[model samples]
Target: MRIVVLAGGIGGARFLRGLKQAAPDAEITVVGNTGDDIHLFGLKVCPDLDTVMYTLGGGIDEEKGWGRTGETWSVKEELAAYGVGPDWFGLGDRDFATHIVRTQMLAAGYPLSAVTEALCARWRPGVRLIPMSDDRVETHVLIDSPDGSGRKAVHFQEYWVRHRASMPAHAVLPVGADRAAPAPGVLEAIGAADVVLFPPSNPVVSIGTILAVPGIREAIADAAVPVVGLSPVVGGAPVRGMADKVLAAVGVESTAAAVARHYGSGLLDGWLVDTADAASAAEVEEAGIRCRAVPLMMTDTDATARMAQEALDLAEEVRA
Candidate 1:
């Protein structure tokens, strides 16, 4: 089986782990979100791609669900001591090496996809992990200043990592996405995949950002395979991250049914909601997408694998 997944950071990475366990023989291709990419201290950081790579490669800090395990923060501490900082992002010593390598390769004229491939050569993430676009497409959040001076746009990292997404966002857009193309193999993978999945990642910033790439969404919508999604929102709340805040900015309710509708029946063939939100299933189905309710918690590998199996089952149903 060929599986294509549009992935974000932690949630998406965890789901991919389960998917790998559930379908060990499947050829999985991940289109990682790059909208969260930011340049910090003259280095390029691709958070989503690194999260997925670390998680799959057995280097992830299991508890935090991001960053390398057994990490030290000497570099971060050194930077802090210098008093030159956006100390909000805790880039550790081990993590700095990744940014250094990526930035160096990028300066040498390699596109993001090639750089990612080189990085993955060490991680061996199992799947073919590719960025959504080699071109720069940053996600920026528009928010009112704390002092009420005026509205201004902030990088996604600043808004999320620094402000902790506490500010009410007026809007979120993938800056430069209007001209970005899908990274090499992204569209081809979608075209050849037997199934496409939208993991329970942040809808607005993760999967939404990937879809923001010019032709990626249209390719998935046009693909012959079934396109299915697992809900990140359970009973009117996100399982992780401040997804509700961004969902609200997009004018979508923080509900499973609403999120499914946000993706729309035209793009999604099937949708999965948690058993707790089973009532929302009918509403989602009524939106012209097939919907089912199952246990959506990723409590452990077994539980997450079960969820992955359920998604594949739903894809088969849609195919039938």
Candidate 2:
């Protein structure tokens, strides 16, 4: 089986792990969200791509669900001692190596797709991970200016990581997405996929950003295979991250049925809601999407794998 997954950061990475366990023999192609990419201290940082790589590569900090495990803070301490700003975003010593190598390669004129392939060679993430676009398509959030003035745009990282999503967002924009083309092999993977999946990642910023790329959404919508999604909002709230805040910014309610409708029946053929949200399944199905209520928590590998299996089963049903 050939599976194509549009993934964000932690949630997406964790779900990919389960997907791998559920379909060990399947060929998986991940179209990672690059809208979260940011340049920090002269280094390129692809958070979503690196998160998926680290999680699948066995280097992820299991507790935090992001960053390198057993990581030291010497580099972060040194930078702090220098009185450099932006201390809110932590970058450990081990994680700095990745950014430095990536920045170096990018300076050498390699596109993001090539650089990602080069990085994955060492990690061997067991899937073909491609960025949504080689061109920089940063996710920016529009919020009221600091002193309660007019509106201003801030980088998604600054809004989410620094401000902790406390500031009310008026809009979310994937800057440069209008002109960005899908990364090499992204369209091909979707075109050739037997099944396409949208994991329980941040709908507005992560998977939404990937779909913001010019041809990605159209490719998936027009694909011959079934496209399915697992809800990030389990019980009228996000299971992780401040997805509700962004979802609100996008004018979508924070509910399983609402999210399924946000994706729409035209794009998504099947939807999965948590057992806690069993009642929402009917509403989702009523919207022309095949909805199934199942256990959606990623409490452990076994539980997550079960969710993955359920998703694949729904895909088969949709195909039938």
Best by lDDT: 1
Would you give me the overall lDDT of model 1?
0.96
What is the per-residue lDDT of model 2 for residues 24-65, given as tens digits with 9 covering 90 to 100?
Answer: 999999999999999888899999999999999999999999
Query: What's the distance in Å from true for residue 277, model 1?
Result: 0.3
TM-score of the candidate numbered 2? Answer: 0.99
- Pairs of residues at least 3 apart in sequence or in different chains that clash in candidate 2: none
lDDT of 2: 0.95
Q: Candidate 1: where is the Cα deviation over 4 Å?
A: none
Q: What TM-score, over all chains together, does every model reach?
A: 0.99, 0.99
How many angstroms is residue 297 displaced in model 2 relative to the true structure, after the best TM-score fit? Answer: 0.3
For model 2, what is the error of residue 123's alpha carbon versus the real structure, in angstroms, after optimal superposition?
0.5
In Å, residue 218's CA in model 1 sits off its true spot by 0.5
lDDT of each: 0.96, 0.95
